[model samples]
Structure formats: structure tokens, C-alpha cells
Target: MDTRNKKRLGAMLLTGIVSLSAIASGCGNNAADDANAGANEQPANAATENAVAGAGMKDGKYDPPITITYLRPWGPDVKFKDGENQDNNVHAKWASEKLGIELKNQWISPSTNNAFETKLRLSLATNEPMPDIISYRGDFNLVRELIDSGRFVDAGELFDKYASETWKKAMDEDPSVWYPYMQDGKRIGIPILDYAYNGDPVMWIREDWMKKLGLSAPKTLDDLEKVMDAFANQDPDGNGKKDTYGLAIGFKNWINTWMSDAGWIFGAFGTMSNQWNLSADGKLEYGSVTPGAKQALATLQDWMGKGYLPTEAGLYDETKAAEDFTAGKAGIVVGPHWMPAWPLEDVKKNNKDAQYKAYPVPSGPNGQAGRHGTSNANGVVLINKDMAHPEAFFTYQNYLFDQFANPPIGGEFEYGLAEGYDWVMVDGKPTTDAAHTGGFAPEKYTITFDGARIPGLNMATLAKLADGGEAATPFEKKLKLSTPQTMLDAAKIVLEQKDITMQQLFTGAPTATMQMNNDILAKMEKDTFSQIIYGKAPIDSFDAFVEKWKASGGDQITREVNEWYQSVSGGQ
Candidate 1:
């Protein structure tokens, strides 16, 4: 409860105004310094050729050290040892000593609110010398601006020339990963990849509550309603008080969210809330304004009237609503596979007997189970065109992927980042005890590679172990030791449903009309949907919403989005 409050307060405070000039003053004369630094440095391309020819670039380390300057969005989550900082952490030291690369931070900005975005804008406005690499995690408009400025490299040719077979194979899993970063037939940036289906939502239920109520996992909408009814009405907590709810959800943003979401409910009806979809006639249409969505909203209104959903769900944020599940006041919550590590696990802390299981969200009357698909890549890693050694970035990145990301059974990072920082010997085995590390800082190790792992890489060993398979690798053994079986089960379910996952066809930055009227439309949509679900508005209000949506810039946004989709997908 306190943590959630603190985060909310922090968000409000962080978003409060800060002087741009004051922040930019900290980076005095960086442009001049970068110019001077480059004046004495060899042209990156010539240096690359000379090194390959003269010293013969090592499969292991460079003969001569190479330095790559980059900007970082630093947050408190990244803990540093007494002698370490962003540019000199264990990962940095490892890169300098073993990979023969020095990582110099051009600047480190806060990774909260819009601090990093503000700093980047200032840097661009002031003509700050671009670093060798720039990692921007927010605002694709900024990425577009960077590309338009022509300061960044077109990495398509460079990537083909330098990316390793392992790295290439990982990227090959999703050909569309490059679409958002492409401009004028050039790949202006390298996609920073995360796991596939990272945003696939699932039903997380308290298994003990189900057993107590003599219910099975829900297979259809009727079954789901019965379960929620049982959970809400029958006192599944066995506390002898009617203080519990069935499903946990937050609609502060929208009913659709990353966690504690109700989007899957609409998705079960063959359309997702707050998304654009292709109609049978091959035209883009807003899902929230559809008749099927009206059905979903009507169902939610029924649930609300029957006390199945939390009464204050419309007011709570995602994490605040998660408090109900964690506090054992709710039995069913829908979220992504990573729930076990968070709100679900916290339930066990609140109630020692709490037993939760992950299951596929029940299918709707349409006989389909659906969830939103996540983008294959988070953000892009852009490089300075002036930096002649773009291949050097690839060499260092590929090594990290090959060596640390997908290491052999008994490899260097089998335990953690450093001996004492991330792990310690516990009865002859490495363990991530909080006492040894003071606090966890996994984000620190990933400062390089733009805080992304090899695509589709996650808990392979643990998932296999959860299926009663042998741990074939050292990393797998460690994962099996640490991860709970519920998480593995959830991940397996997510993988099983990868085929059914859907993403927006348009992945570009917001369109011009969207920028101007998106907020107005979003507020209208949320208000109308919430009112409908809360029974404050008639179900027929959806038709009115569709008309208003089309009139108030949504139609233009759709046209622009379809244009973007056509441009990226070659009008397929």
C-alpha cells in the first residue's frame, strides 16, 4: 500500500516543472568538448579498416581499446558499488578489460516522467555533439526528428555487415521489428529486442479459492461468470465476511492496461478495447466503438451490478487495484505472465495459505481467447553517422549477447553480474540474497546493449524444469533454483497462445490528428465506456461515441495510421 502511494506521489512530483536551462547548464560546453575529442581521433571507418588489417581484429578482444560515447537514462533502480558509477560499473569494467571497449557516458538523465526526453530536446536544440550511440526509449517523434536531422547512421547495411549469426537469428524471429525504425528505405536504428509476446495477458486466479468453491478453470464466458460469482458471493477467502471481490481491475487510464486489465474480456469477444482493428472489408476501425465492444461493456455492467468487480475499480490505478489481490480481497486478476514475481506473490505474504495459478483467460461466446500483442522491440539504438566504427558497437553488443546473454551451461555469468554485487555463495551455491547485495540492481548490468536482452530469451531452464524436465544448463539450474513454478507455467501458457496474439497494424508515432485531439478522444472514450460499464449511460451510447469519434479527429487518425501501415508494410 505504502509503495504504491509513494510511486504515485513520486510520479506527480517528478512530472512537476523543472528548469530546462538549469538542467542543460550541467552539460556545459559538451559540444565543444566532443569536437575537440574527435579532432585528435582517427576517422572511425579508416580506424576500423586499419585495425582489421594491421592488428587483425580479435574474435575475443580488440588489439587497441576503442571508446564509445553514449547517453543513458539513469534511475535509482540501478545500484552501484562503492567504487562504481554508470561509466565504471562491473559491466563497464568488464567491457574495458575483456572486450577492449571503454563506455563513456555523454550524460545520464533521470528515467522518469519526461526527464530524458526533455534532456534530449535540449541537447538537440543546443546542437550538442551527438555521441557514438544514443538510446531513446520514449517518443518515436524524437527518433524521427533524430533521423531527419541526419546525424544518425542508416544501420541496415552496417547491421548486415556486423551483426553475428546468433544475434541475426534472434532478430529473424520478427521481421517487423525493424518497421518502426525504418525511414526512406534505411534502417536508422537497431531495434532493442525483448521477449516475444511480452504483453500477452492471462487469467491469474487463486487456486485454493477455486478448490474451496468446487470450481474448475474457466473455459468459456459462462464458466468465467460462474467463477466470478462464486468468488464474489460465496466468500472464497473463508473469512466469513463479504469483503471480497471477484476480479481486480483498474480503469484510471482505461479498462485496457498492461496489468490488472479488463481488455482481454473485450478481446475474448474478438476485439480489443482501445485499439484499431481491420474489419472484414479490409478497413481500419476503432474496436472500442464496435457492437461487440458494447456486448463486453454490458457484461462488465452486469458484473459490476452483481458485485463481481471492485466497486472502486474505476478510480484505482493498476497497481492500486493490484492491492486488492495482494491483500487477499480479490481472488481473480488478469495480467501478464510476470504476475508471480509481484502482486500474486504478495498475496502469499498477506495470506500464508494463498495458492495462485495462471490460466488462459476464458474464451468468449465467439469461441476465441485473445490478448493484445506487444511490440517486438521496445526502442531503438541509434548511432552517430560521424562515428566511423558502427561495427564496433555491433562487435561489443554481439559479444555481450553471445557471452552473457546465451552463455554455455557453465559460463561466466552463470550466477550473476559480479561475485558479491548480484550473488553470493550460499551453501556452495550462488544465491541473490538481499543481505549480500544490499539491494538488487539487475538494471545496472544491462546499461550496455541499451537495457535489452537477446530476443525471445527468458527462463528457458526454469520453464523446462517446471515441466519436470532436466536442467541442461548452468543458467537453467540457477533459474530453477530461483523462479516459482507458477511463473514458468504462465510463460508456457503465453507461448502456447502466441498464434492468437494481436498487435496494432500501425506501430509508428502518433499521427498529427492524434497529437492534437488524442487526449480529447481518449477522455471521451474512457468516460463513455466507464459510464456504460457503471450503468450511468445507455448501451446505445456506443453508437453516439462512434459518431463523435469519427467527427472529432479519429477518422483522420485512422487514415494517417493506415497510410503509415501501408508505407511500412509496402501496402501489402
Candidate 2:
């Protein structure tokens, strides 16, 4: 998942605002002293040739240390050691000492209140000299704006020429990761990758409830309904009150969301709401208007009528919806494999005997089972076209990708970023405990918020562990030491059903029509879906809503989406 979404989820868990929008505002020219300083010191062509020839290094270090300037977005979650700041952190020191690269922050802005985005947009608007590297994790529009400014280089060329083979292979695993950063047949930015399938849904059921009710794993919709009935009716919690529900879900935001997701319900019916899906004719279509959505809505109506969900489920957001299950009022919730480490863990705190496990999502009536898939790319790293050392950024990132990301056993970073920060030696053994380490997150200090991650390595490693494979690699050993058995089991289930995961086909910025009318269309879809599920509207009303949606803006949006898709995909 992207750092933006990760921050949002963290805020939500801490009872902060669940949604945050970047606000464009004026910013001071604090970066004037640092902007393009290095570029002016050398000829552009000469610098480019030198950078390429030397691969930004001479004997594993830049002969004369090169400076790389950056603009950073600092958030409340970003902590520092007693006398360190973003510009003078452990990561900066390491880069300077090891790579002979002077990492400097041109300016720092708060990410929480959109100051960073405001500053970046201001730089674009004012034609300010750009920083050497811009690691943006905010709005895609801002990224497109940066690309459109014509100040960035074709990163694809540099990546091809300089990226480590390991890093290139990781990026090659999902070519679509470049879609959002493409401009005029040039890859303008390099994607900041994360674990793939990190957000894909899995069925999380209370194993204790299942065992208490003597119910087997639900393999299909009919079997799931029986289990739901038992969970709602029987005293699985042994309180003898009909206060519990069968399933926990929320539609206050969208059917498909990061937490307490209900996308699998529509997925089971062969569609996913609130996204663009590839149709049989190879065109993008709005998923909410697909015929399968009608059936999914009907099923939700049936579940609602049977008292299988919370009365206020329509008003609950992701965190609010998960509360019911965490509070022991619901038995089943669909979410990613990480749920066991979070909201699901709270269930055990509420009841020490609460035992939850991940299961494959039940199939629909026609044996179709599907769910939302996660995008491998999170944010992006864009470089200034006029930078004196374009390869320096890649050199720094490549080292992270090859060594720090999945450290070799007995390597420098095999334990963590630095001893006494993310890991510490305690009793002759290294442990990653907050109490001993002071919970310092040195990775957050890196240019890329979470450093580098291979998109497919995480879940693949977990799945291998689940399949009785040895923890052979350092990455595998890290997972074995930190990840719970339940999550490993869930990873295997996610991999087993990878074929059915429906990733959003369109990955570009919003089209003109979408920018203008998406709010109206989204509200229309949400209201209609919620009404139909709550019996406020008839099932047939969905058909009328679909027609109205197309007439209003959806039809044009679909065409524009496909046009954008064809442009990025080369008409594939």
C-alpha cells in the first residue's frame, strides 16, 4: 500500500480524521538557496556523461562528493533522535559516508495539513528551480503537474542504464506500475514499490465461534449463509443474547476500502464496485454499474433483512465497522492478511479465548470468487532533468533495493536500519521491541518513506513459509520471526486465489469528465446501492440508476478512461 493510505489508516486507528485532502496554498521561497545549485556548477551535458560513465561512483564512492537536494513532506508520525532532524539524520549520515552523496533537504513541509503539496505546487507555479530529486507521495495530479512542468528527465532511460538488475526485475514484475508516471512515451518517474497483494481481501472469521457452533469452513455462498445464520442466532459468545451479527461491513465510504471491506461480496458476483474493470470487449467500464452489482446488492438486502448486520452499518466507516468484530459483536469480517496484527488482535484483548483465522473468500452461487487486488506502486521518485548527477538517486535507491530491502543473512542491515533504533542488542540477541529500542523508525528518515521493497517478495515469502518451506533467506527469516502464523496462512490463501483478484485496469490520473462530475456520479452510486441494500429502493431501481449515470457523465468518463488506458498501454 502507498504511504498516503498507510498514514490515513494510522490516523484512523488513532481516532484522527479518516480522510484528508491536499489543499493548495501559497508557500515561501525557502528553497531558493539550494535549488539548482549543483546544476550551475557544471555543464549539463558533461555532468550527464560523467554520471553515466561513472555510474555516479568511482570505486564505490563519488570521487568528489556530490550533493543531491530534495523537498520532503514531514508528518507527525516521523520522529527523530534527540539531536537529529530530517536533514541531519542517520540515513543522511550513512549516505554521505558510504555513497559519498551529500543528501540535503531543500525544504521541509508538514504533510498532515497539505503544506508539502502546497509548497510543491507553488514551486511549479512560480517556475522555481527544481530540487535534484522529488519523492512525492501525495496526489497524482501533483505528480502529473510535476511531469507536465517539463523539468524532470525520462527516468526510464536512467533506470534502464543504471538500476541494479534486482531492482529492474522488481519493477518488471508489474509494468503497469509506470502507467501513472508516463508522459509522451517517456517514463517521467520511478515508482516507489511495496509488497503486492498487501491490500487484497481475505475472509477473517472467529475460529472460536466456528468451533463453538460446530460449523465447517464456508466454501460457497450457501455455506457462508448457514454459518452467518449460526453466528447470528446461536450463542457463539455464550452470552445468550441476540446482540451479535453475522458479518461486519461498512459502506459509508465505498464498498471497496482498505479496512472492513465489502468488495469481495461484489467480487463473488463477478464485479467490484467503485473501480474500473476490463470488460470482455477490452474496454474499461464502471464496476458499480455492472449487472453483477445488482445481484450483490440483492444479497446484501437479504442479509440486512435477516438481521445479519449492524443496524447502523450504512453509517459506519472502515474503522467503525471493524469495531463490531473487535468488540465481539460480529463473527466474520473481510480484510487483508494484516488484520490479525491490528483490529483482530483487539478481539483477543476483549475476550482472551477469541481465536480468529483467515479463510478463502466463499464462492458465489455460480462458483465465482474474486476480490480487489492491490497496486504494486505506491508513490514515485522524479528527478530534475538539469541535475548534475541523475544517477546518484538511482545509485542510492539501488543500494536500498539490493541490500537493505531484503538483507542477506549476516549483512549490515540483517537486523534493522541501525542498532538501538529499529533493533537493539538485548541479552545477546537482537530484538525489535519498542521498549528496548525507543521505537525509533529510521526507515521513515530515508528519501523514500519506507525505503525499497520488492512488490512480490513479501507474500511470496509468507506463502513459501506456509507451505513448509525453510526460512532460507534473510527476508524469509525476518517474516518467520515477526509475522504471525495466521497471517502466513492467510498469505497462502491470498496466493492460491491470485488468479481471481481483479485489479483496477485504469491507473492514470482522472479524466476530464471524472474531474468534473465524479463526485456526483459517486454519490449517485453510493446512495442507490445503500438504498437498495437497506430496502429503501427496489432492486429494479439499479437499472434506472445505471442509465441515468451513463447519461449524466459515466459514459463519457468510460470512453476517456479507455482512451487514457490505450495511451499508456500502447493499445494493448
> What value does the lDDT take at residue 206 in candidate 1?
88
Candidate 1 residue-wise lDDT at 57: 57
Q: What are the per-residue Cα lDDT tens digits for candidate 2 across 1-572?
A: 33234533443233211101100000111111111121122222233234556454665567688899997677787788989998888889998898788999888888876779888888888988999999977676788888888999999999888787667767877899899899888899989876677777789999999998899999998999999999889978999798888999987777787778888888889998888898888887878899999999999999999988777888998889999999999999998777777668899889998999999998998999988877777689999989987788877787777677667666677788888788899999988777888878787888887777766667766776777778766556666777778877887888788888898877777789988998798788888998999999999999999999999998999889988999999767
Candidate RMSDs in Å, in order, are 9.6, 8.5
| TM-score, every prediction | 0.87, 0.91
Candidate that would win on TM-score: 2
Off by over 4 Å in 2: 1-56
**TM-score for predicted model 2 compared with the true structure:** 0.91
lDDT score at residue 547, model 1, on the 0-100 scale: 91
lDDT against the true structure, per candidate, is 0.69, 0.78
